[model samples]
Target: MIRSILLTAATGLLLSACAQPPLRGTGDLGVVIERASGSVQIIESDSHTALARLEGLGDLSHASVVYSRDQRYAYVFGRDGGLSKIDLLSQRIDRRVIQGGNSIGGAISQDGKLIAVSNYVPGGVKVFDARTLRQVADIPATPLADGSKRSRVVGLVDAPGQRFVFSLFDTGEIWSADFSQGASPKITRFNNIGQQPYDALITPDGRYYMAGLFGEDGMAQLDLWHPERGVKRVLGDYGRGQEKLPVYKMPHLEGWAVADNQAFVPAVGRHQVLVMDARTWRQTAAIAVAGQPVFVTSRPDGRQVWVNFAYPDNDRVQVIDTETHAVVADLRPGPAVLHMEFTARGDQLWLSLRDGDQVQVWDPYSLKPVSTLPAAAPSGIFFSSRAQKTGY
Candidate 1:
């Protein structure tokens, strides 16, 4: 009897250990801010429920959310330059890093060691330590000698060999940096890529980096290792003016969906996701989507791509098949569906609805609504690594 009881206890302990949750991520907390008051609301992704509502943030207009590598903490930036650090699991605001600047965009490094945010008003970028949430480096974005407007660093992507790439708005250039060994990240100005290469993404294998074009109807690609020879145009002029109406606009190449060496890029003005062969950087085909597709994200398996947008009518999200490149299902979560993200498991999708004051959850495969998580003005939806601990 004693031996049997001991074995039973050991088995119970093992089962309990397996049931324990995982760690948090830097970019996992789903944030919704009250547009009028800047009230911050956080939802712990594991529960699909409200974790906390923080008040008195004071009108954080259009804040950006990026979680840590582990998803334990979230770094938020407001338009007026308010930066708040939130503990995802504990459901509390850890600290406000700084205040005052035109903080527009932010990105966590690939290794999750460094984070950089754009300061449009004061002019430059602020680099923070991802682990401790400390200000480590500040790179001043001085205007070029030609008397051009001061360029704002809008988007950032980290590549292999510990290198980082950032997009410059004024000069329309992609800047490269190495933060692995340098004291301050070294910025090497690469050749210009099109008129305005707004945002960029590194391939999964870290071979090439592609930048989204803002001024025209195409994108630019660069060899990650070379960097200096500069970028080549990948997609442009989809016979739009001649064949159909102009479908793309400036700075809207926002969504990137990658599946099996193929990059699905949404040329928003064109209302289609252009499938490109990542190996050759050639256009395979374009998938038709409904009105003004704002963001394109996918599940872990890369089988389905989710596109969210406002317009031809109300805001909605559509799921597309990666293999077929066709619209599989349409999910109308709410109005102003700005961004969507999938859990690490690829089971559930979270939607950040701006107008409805809630974040909606859906089965990415079935396209069925599971739950509606309330928030004031949810701009972006993310799943922290910690929030995925409950096996979500």
Candidate 2:
């Protein structure tokens, strides 16, 4: 009896030790931000299903997520300046910190050791240690020339050589902080880049950075390869002839809008998507669209560009043929279409229909819905693939 009891207990302990969640990889996983609930739902791209919902993330009114280099963690930047590092494997927030009063967006460094956030409340950029959520560096937005008020920082992105670049909306300037030497970053500022620079994007190759000016028609370009060349004004005459219309919501220059040696962007205060030649930084053509464009996204193959519009026409999504610069397809997903994201391989397209309380998956080529998943006021759909991209 004693021998039998020993064997049974040994087997019980062995079973207990082996009792754990099934192992899985994170490459196929992603997250959807539920803005109303202040939570994010972990999802699987292959199955098109919601695996888990992790909550308690604060103030997601304008939340954006960037993944860790290993794709194991997601760094979420919230409007209330809450930085939450979520572990994808365990499906929980591993560490979180309130780093600022107001933050717009953030980026992870090329080496993935640092996370930089752009703020508006205190108007500065804060660098934090990725693992522990510890603040490593604080670079305040350069105060205006008079030294009265700090400028609100926008368009923050991680460039090559462990550097972070951003634009100052209040000061019309762009600054680059190089952190390769040590904790203290060497700062480089370019003033008068443009009036009211709203947002910016870096090219796929990390060679050029473009800032879209809201106070004026043109955009300011900074060639990362040659800092001495300074900012070159492009599309300077874009909005000259037409009467500028009221902007319902500021457009985003976030997505990788470059395709086939051409860069595509949303025209401010107009119903068009501007096409520019990547080589010369000159406006090639402006394709008229359904309404004021919000997010202009290109597929992984760079064959087509998909655009979503602002308020009154928020329900519509228009597809542009990159080769011909023409509207090929116009789709109305639903009311309150907040954001759009494509799978890593560009096999499927996902859109957050806030009014419909669902995330709709579709065939980008056919413009047909594949499936709809329920969500509570979803805003942004981000994939782990962005972890490897330069200007994600």
Candidate 3:
């Protein structure tokens, strides 16, 4: 009887000595970029609370994030060419490296094993092992005709295969680095895609990769499934007759454009959002907005599309009914609305007000404020749901 009792007590003590099991999953967790401070506020979507603050991420003035396939980790790309791997459950930066001089954005491979960053100063795409932040391949941008220097890279995104596609801004060309084979990828070059391809995005299905043209009125689209068809220009004249304003890449391109059968794209320097037929790549309609639109994002449900403008009109937001192709709600939020993110299923719409120093959530249907979370010069709000998304 004494030995049995001792054994029971010893087992209980050993069990208590072990670490506790994880209490929360990472699915509802995310991070908000604190641009000025070079830190991020780890937030929870359900409770609408900030759980942790991770600092020393480097220059995040133009920072962007992508997620691992499981959504447990976030990869942040900063303007100072710093790439950080953050673990949500641990609330810490797992790995970090200064991979470039100036990085605009980054994307994770389809398999979630690689991370690619598009740089401006060094002017190329750097690929690293997602977990270790170790360089695997270095693909340089095409050199200018005069060979003065390499062109700047933009619109870096991962496709269906284990490939990284990006555009060269100075040279107006698109290159595909197929990494599926191994560290040395097969490179395919599409020269003269446009005058200057500013930014790009891949369709949800990963079939079409479209790069926005800042030097022209149209965009360049490549059918990834059939790259042999070459790059085709779509909506070539949609912005020709509008009051054009020079289109620039937002600090954080959080606005998602493709929704179901239609693509809601922001017209280059116009107070309008152009609706295009996703199948034929033709303009169906151009809905006039409050000002020159900066971020044109659609809810996950594909039922509503919300827009935030640039400069003086940046405070106002408008929602469009995709079915009716009409502006439904006009909301006046805080100043300098930098970016917008929808909850995994569109239950809530979150926005970062840089000038307001706040993060606001709203009901996508009623267009009313749900909750307000204070932030420090917040620029981007990303949710873990992005882990399961393509071209995030």
Could you say which candidate leads in lDDT?
2
Candidate 1 local lDDT, 1-392, one digit each (tens)? 99999999999998987765444444535655556567767765567777678775544666666766666777777787777777665666777766346777566776677777777766677777776668888776658667564677766655666666667766777777778785477778765676766666666666677776666656677787776667787766522223244443332333577788887776555666778886777888988888656667867798888887656434777888888888988766767776677777777787777788777888776678889876777665545652322101
Please give, for residues 1-392, the per-residue lDDT of candidate 3 as tens digits.
Answer: 99999999999987876544356788998999999999999999898899999999999998989999888899999999999999888788999999989888989998999999999978899899888899999998888889888899999989988888899999999999999989888999999888888788888888888887766667798999999999999888643334356544331233547777898887756778888888999989889888878888888889899898888888899999999988999999889998899999889999999999999989888899989998999998999998888888
How high is the lDDT of residue 195 in model 1? Answer: 70
Off by over 4 Å in 1: 1-37, 56-60, 131-134, 142-149, 238-254, 386-392
The lDDT of model 2 is 0.89
Q: Which 10-residue window of candidate 2 scores lowest in summed lDDT?
A: 235-244
* Residue pairs of candidate 2 with colliding backbone atoms: none
Comparison by TM-score, 1 against 2, better one: 2
TM-score for candidate 1: 0.81
Better lDDT candidate (1, 2):
2
Superposed Cα deviation of residue 372, candidate 1 (Å): 1.5
TM-scores vs. true structure, each candidate: 0.81, 0.94, 0.93
lDDT per model, in order?
0.67, 0.89, 0.87
Per-residue lDDT value at 150 in model 3: 85
